[model samples]
Target: MSTVIELAPGVRAGFTGRDGGVSREPYATLNLGGHVGDDPEAVAENRRRAARGFGLDPRDVVWMNQVHGADAVTVTGSGPAGDVDAVVTTVPGLALAVLVADCLPVLVADAEAGVVGAAHSGRPGMAAGVVASLVAEMERHGARPERCAALLGPVVCGRCYEVPEELQEEVARSVPEARCTTDAGTPGVDIRAGVTAQLKRLGVTNVTHDARCTRESTDLFSYRRDATTGRFAGYIWKA
Candidate 1:
């Protein structure tokens, strides 16, 4: 079964794991990132497979160029949304995707308004407000946060996301809910907690989360666990 959540009527959102693709080892079999040194042809084919698996045409999905920033881009067509961490769309049937390894992938939708958005929230992006930008964009299209169904996909949990005290403090200063103590008693950042708090603060009431930690799950890709690794994707679409 897919890990994708059915956010609302006619709207579906999900995250992918490493299982089916053509990229060589490290990125072997199912790596979807085109800029991660994976074979371009292999990545293209993998993307097509992912799209088809979701009942969407390869050309019907909009991918993003995420730089761990807070930029949110709106889309009405199936093309790359450049240098953005989030992508929002009001067009039914158009899918928005965000690639992540250890970072959190957020998918949200208001099916009644035909608005859906996906965001890539890493420690920096979370502190910078990527999810907030997505919600604002969705709101512009008539989707209220109170009516949106949201899902936070697999992420590097705090227990495995140890960081320097300074770095952790920096992130926590911007998003207090993200700070945590690792299992080893080191400083950590809870990307999922920070994002969930952000969603709640935005008034999004129906938030759900996939409890899997990318760093801990062998099935999912994790850059923290494997520096050079494949990237899985999170997808959102309206039917």
Candidate 2:
């Protein structure tokens, strides 16, 4: 069975590990993203299995093009939502999914409002305010930030994500909490920390983070660690 993380009652939210599917080595077993050059059939079957983990049909899940921007679209149906990094929904049984490697996959839910959202927050998306936009979209669907709880999924931690000084400075300008140093003392951005701060600023205080770093954990996919590899998913849905 696929490993699942429970977030709230009437809401299912969790990250997928890299296992239990039909893809080959690089995309190897359980690659849920179609854009990563994995066989379309393998990706489809993987998705079907993922949905089954939550007791829903594969068609019940909604995915996005994930352009690494701040667009959070409200989805009512299960299909591609175009070039957006985030998706939100109040529809029960319809899952919202975000594909990620080193980037953070954020899941949010206001169970009482029957709304949930998922976002792909990479360096660019974080700078573009993806998490904040997601919160706003959730609110638009009647989800109050103070009542909403967020899950910051596994990602490349600051200690492993080395970047140039200028890029770090640029992102940190808008998200100060993102500024950090790598293990080798090089500049880096702690995206999960920054996202957590942003969520709190938006009034989403009930936040939980999966502290495991994708780059450091073989259980998760990491683009920085394996450039030609698969992408895992973070999914959220209301019961």
* lDDT (10s digit) by residue, model 1, range 22-57: 889989789999888888999999999888887888
**lDDT score, candidate 2:** 0.89
The list of candidate 1 runs beyond 4 A from truth reads 1-4
Total residue pair clashes for candidate 1: 2
CA lDDT, candidate 1, residue 202: 95
Pairs of residues at least 3 apart in sequence or in different chains that clash in candidate 1 = 4-14, 21-30
Model 2: worst 10 consecutive residues (lDDT sum):
1-10
Q: Over 4 Å off in model 2, which ranges? A: none
> Mind giving the per-residue lDDT tens digits that candidate 2 earns over 1-239?
33566687788777788888889989888888898889998999998987887677888889899898998889889888889998888888898888999999999999888889999999999999999899999999899999988899899999999999999999999999999999999999999989999999999999998899999999888889989999998888887
Q: What lDDT is reached at residue 167 by model 2? A: 96
